[model samples]
Target: MKSISKYWSIFQITLINSLAYPGELVGRSLMIIPFMWIFYQLWKVTFSAAGAADGMINGLTLRDTLWYLMLAETIELGRPPIARTMSENVKDGSIAYILNKPYDFLLYQFSTAMGETIFRAMLNAVFGGLTVWWLVGTPNHPEGFLIALPAIFGAWILHFSINAMIGLSAFVVEDVSAFTWIYQKLAFIFGGMLIPLDFYPQWLQNIAKLLPFSSAIYGPARLFVTPTLELFISVMSLQITWIIALTFALAIVYRRGLAQLTVNGG
Candidate 1:
């Protein structure tokens, strides 16, 4: 308990430092605006064509598709960019100091990442809210906001855990940047960032749902269009399951990695 509290304090300090860099925060926040606008235009064009041919694609009207894209863009931008940070720390030997601390390194990282994620989420929500209003209008389903809160929070946990696992590979690999890039591309394709899962083929959609990537954006984005208690429970359950599995797997990796570190003393 004391160790956890100690790490939490450190994470808080890190969170404050992250916020102190206003220029970096503003730059990253501004970058998302153009990406959101590009996606909005692309989806608008795609939906216009699809709606003309078939009347609707995957049960979504052109309006619904735009809203889906809006939610997805916001979620994608809001997700913490932890993998690169972790990889750099490990490659530079900063991870060794973290490991030597009395607290669980992964837990400390998780806490700090969560703090950063919450801050980003709030910023994105404000920006996204205004953008959606101006572009697509507010979501028709009022209940969508209620469902979104829990789903987004669960999605954050799932994202953090999976990223932690990927970052942990730096203990073995000489370069994790390539691997992180691959994971990011996969997430963009399969995680419903570029397009909603409903637009994918049935088998691909099924496989995507089974993967941790979808929980990051798709599940929460779906809440805005088809908010339901059952869907919320199901999405949250999947995220919880992934979080537990990844946490256990990371624990094993940390134990073994530390043992190797002790043996090498390098």
Candidate 2:
């Protein structure tokens, strides 16, 4: 463990590698174009049928909902497949080399993930924004975006920590596929991916907010579309809290997993 700079360099390398396939990155980002249209039609039809007083549903205008989805997918689509990566490393004895390195293995893993994630996340966010512009024009909540900046950064940290926890669980579970799938569903339903939390029943919304899933995905998107200073403070505070808690939990899991490692020595 030399210093933070060492792992930061690893982060830089990972970021550079992600840019190696700029075309592929742009292509993958196009996935959001259709996503925006589908949701746009769905909301448009739903709102037309709802025929509410002001084209609003459950406290959100259709425009607000679409932007929420855009922000959510920006974070969601950028996620790396770390569970399999971690499992492969553990199975192939690569974990041994990683643990012996000067920089902290956990820090190195997180740095690399963040580095690569920034590339993908930036692309996804830009594409998603463009889709929003083409479909709905400028964001209705411009002020909300200013507050969302810190919230989005916090959410990214929380997102990485949650995935890192799943990956590090390779020590306890041979496979993390089931866990990741279940978590993804939770994120879709509770993290307000498929829809915003406001659409949910009051009790269900409470449960969603209580989970880290919401803090990771919904918190940032929610802050961007709904701009109350109180809410901005609340979501950012919760995101920071979850980031600390999840990072600590990941450290504990890694320490235990490292201690459990056995060598085949004469």
Candidate 3:
């Protein structure tokens, strides 16, 4: 318990340090704005052209698509750059010191990442959601909101686990940056960041359902516009399954890596 508290305190200190750099913080926050604007405009144009035919594109209304875009932005904000964090620690040899500590390094990173993720989520909910909502009314539906709660929470857990697995790769590879970049691009592309999964071809959509990336964005975005009990169960179940699988895999990697780590002076 004391060890947990100490690691959490360290995480809080890191969070405060992040908040102190106002310029960097604002700049990072603003980076998502243009992407949001582009997607919003593209969706608006598509809906305008489709008119009543928009339903052909997955039975989605213009408003539903807009809400999907908004939800995607929010999810992106909540995602932690765990790959980068692990790569940095490994490169700087800080991971050695972390391993020597009496605390669990994985838990320490997870807690810190969660803190940053929550903070970013709040900022995006206010600034990102507000900017879009003001221009286009809030995408609110009582049923959607009710269903979204569980979906979003499940998505966060699944996302964190996926990232933890990626971070674990740092133990094997000297440069995980390239892998991280490719993984993120694939996540955004197939995870429904640019467009809803329903917009994808049937075969692609089926494949995506089996992957963890879809739970991160597509599952929750769909919840906002199409509330179904089955969808909720499926999304939550997949997330839980992936979390367990990834955690087990990471445990193996950690044990093996620790055994192999060579200490010169100790």
Candidate 4:
């Protein structure tokens, strides 16, 4: 209970700190507007070109695609760059200060990352949602937001586990930009960030769905589009499985990194 309170206080402080520069927060969020607009134009052309009955491609209509894209963008753009931040701390040896702190390092990072995520994601949702709504009317399942909420949170936990593992690599490599770039591209392609997995060929869809990246992006975004109980269960089940697996992997990596850790400076 006391330990939980300490992390909760850390979360609260980071949340408040994120709001300190409202202009920067809002400015960064505005990038989602152009992204949504471009998606609208590109997908409009795509739906037109495909000429699928009633503007539908695969299982999704144009409106559904737009809404899905909006949520996908919100998830991608909202989270803080945890890997890069941790890498910087490692490179500068500032992690020594953090190691001296009382709280568990992983929990502390999760609390702070989530605190930073809340407002950015909300703003991205507002801007991206309005843009998508204007491009195509309201989502078919407005209640899907409520339904997909848990999965969205789980998505971030999965992301943090993976990215933290990547960050932990910096203890040895001291630079992780290459790994970060590869991870982003993998997520964009395999995670259905650019196109829903349903649109993919059957074999590819099967493979992509099995990946943690899909659970982080595609699962929640798809749930937000459809929001059936079965999907909610499926998404959460996959997410929990990935979260548990990746979290254990992260712990192993963290322990190894600590043994290998070499701070460059005082």
Q: Write the per-residue lDDT of candidate 4 for residues 33-59, one digit (tens) a residue.
A: 999999989999999999977778888
By TM-score, how accurate is candidate 1? 0.89
lDDT per residue (tens digit) for residues 1-266 in model 3: 78768878877876786677767666677666676677778887887777664344677776677777777777777667887877667667787777776778778877777667766766665666666776567775747856887777777766666666666667677678787788788888778888888878999999987787887788888887778888778777887787788777877776776664553213
Per-residue alpha-carbon lDDT of model 2 for 1-266, expressed as tens digits? 45867877898999999989899988998998899889999988888898999889898888888898999999888877766677667767687777777777877887877787887888888888888888878888878877888888787778777777787677777578888898889889989998898888899988889888899889989889988889988998888888889999988887777765663211
Candidate 2 Cα outliers beyond 4 Å, as residue runs? 263-266
Question: Model 2 lDDT vs. the true structure?
Answer: 0.83
Better of 1 and 2 by TM-score: 2
* Candidate ranking (TM-score, best to worst): 4, 2, 1, 3
lDDT, each prediction = 0.75, 0.83, 0.73, 0.93
The lDDT of model 3 is 0.73
- Model 3 alpha-carbon drift over 4 Å, by segment: 1-11, 53-56, 142-146, 263-266
Instruction: Name the top TM-score candidate.
Output: 4
| Alpha-carbon RMSD, candidate 3 | 2.6
Whose lDDT is greatest here? Answer: 4
Model 4 residue 72 CA deviation in Å: 0.6
lDDT of 2 at 156: 71
Q: Which ten residues in a row have the lowest lDDT in candidate 2?
A: 257-266
How well does each candidate superpose onto the true structure, as a TM-score? 0.89, 0.94, 0.87, 0.98
Pairs that clash in candidate 4: none
